[model samples]
Target: MAGAAELFVWWVLAVVLQVFLTGPLSWLEWTVAAGAAVPAAFGARAVRRASGAGSGGGARALHAVLVWPVALVADTGRLASLTLRALRGRQVRGRFQTLELGRGTGAAWACTLLSATPGAYAVGLGRGRFVLVHTLPGPPGVLADALTDGRRS
Candidate 1:
């Protein structure tokens, strides 16, 4: 089954990560990783199914993993610069804006990405097509730019 295959992949990944992090896995560690991987994989599968996201979910998830950290770092630096500028008596403005995301899963993904970054907070969802976000007076359209570009670049 697809779930079994997914679990096996996760199990292998866990084992590999354990080896990389702790430098070689004991039998007990292997057992623990195997046990943990099964439940985690199942939970992940459930979430993916519940989200009803389309077929490219894996690619999107991978892309997010690869680019999110870079974006987070960039956004944090930008936020700090803006904060310092504000402290120097420059005007800083924040606004609550609604964006049309066009799909439920897309909106959810966008919201999640926005909230995880430093300068943005995804506050609400509306009618399965819009997301409300607050940007903390940095460059506008961080979320919009990320979504449109399909990467944090």
Candidate 2:
């Protein structure tokens, strides 16, 4: 019953996302979206259950979505600046920094999300929920700063 509920929820989310991405759809498009949603929903449900990530992820997921584009754009600009600075004979340093991580799903999601941006690459999840990330010299992007604050702040 719980799995069924979760699957249904995932299906709805998949359909909604399809609509959001594609805009208004004709009957054929709706049929295609509904068909594609089943596999997408099952994949989401499987990943969630297999990973054993508990509920209460909605806010985190929403936060990640909001953070992603900003991080991408900010990091892109930062990278361009670094390139120009380096071309002008300024030193560009890349450093590895350790950030504290919360136990459970937050660490994985945070690392994955942070690494998706251009300026930071999470090296590993280390001792006591610490993650090592290598970042280009500059101000950390929004995602990295939020992640460095350790799941709250």
Candidate 3:
């Protein structure tokens, strides 16, 4: 029952967001549509149960949608800058370094942020003690600063 409720809520929220973006539907229409979606939420639980998955699909989907745009913009800027530098045949120094991160989900979040940004990628982890990252121009310190501050890290 909980799973169904979760699924319904996810679908309704998705519909609401779509209506908001499309802007063709009036608020009353959106509200009505959202209310109607409530029953479909149960389907989410069934899908998860059938797949034997534990994670909340709705939350994951929402996170992906939210993060992807930010990642794309950051990557685009990085690629443009790198391209400009490459045109001059500048010696692009690259750096590989490990960073100690707080345990658990924070580490994952940090890695995602780094991987999404341009000219940087989280390649691996070592000793479960640090995250390994590769960066162009060989300034691991700058990258570290960004990551630590929750900006580009």
> How well is each residue in 68-124 modelled by candidate 1, as lDDT tens digits?
667777878888888899899999787776666532235545566678778678787
Question: TM-scores of the models, in the given order?
Answer: 0.56, 0.61, 0.43
Whole-model lDDT, model 2:
0.73
- Sort every candidate by lDDT, greatest first: 2, 1, 3
TM-score of 1: 0.56
Ranking by TM-score: 2, 1, 3
| Candidate 3: tens digits of C-alpha lDDT, residues 1-153 | 765556755586557656756788877888876776565445544554564434433443444446655655655676678778889997556677666643232344456556756756889765543678887663443334544433233
List candidate 2 segments past 4 Å from native: 1-57, 102-105, 150-153
Weakest ten-residue segment in model 1 by summed lDDT: 144-153
RMSD of each: 5.7, 4.8, 8.1
Residue 62 error for model 1, in Å? 3.8
Clashing pairs in 2: none
Candidate lDDT scores, in order, read: 0.63, 0.73, 0.57
Which candidate's TM-score is highest?
Answer: 2
Q: Give the CA lDDT, 0 to 100, for residue 2 in model 3.
A: 68
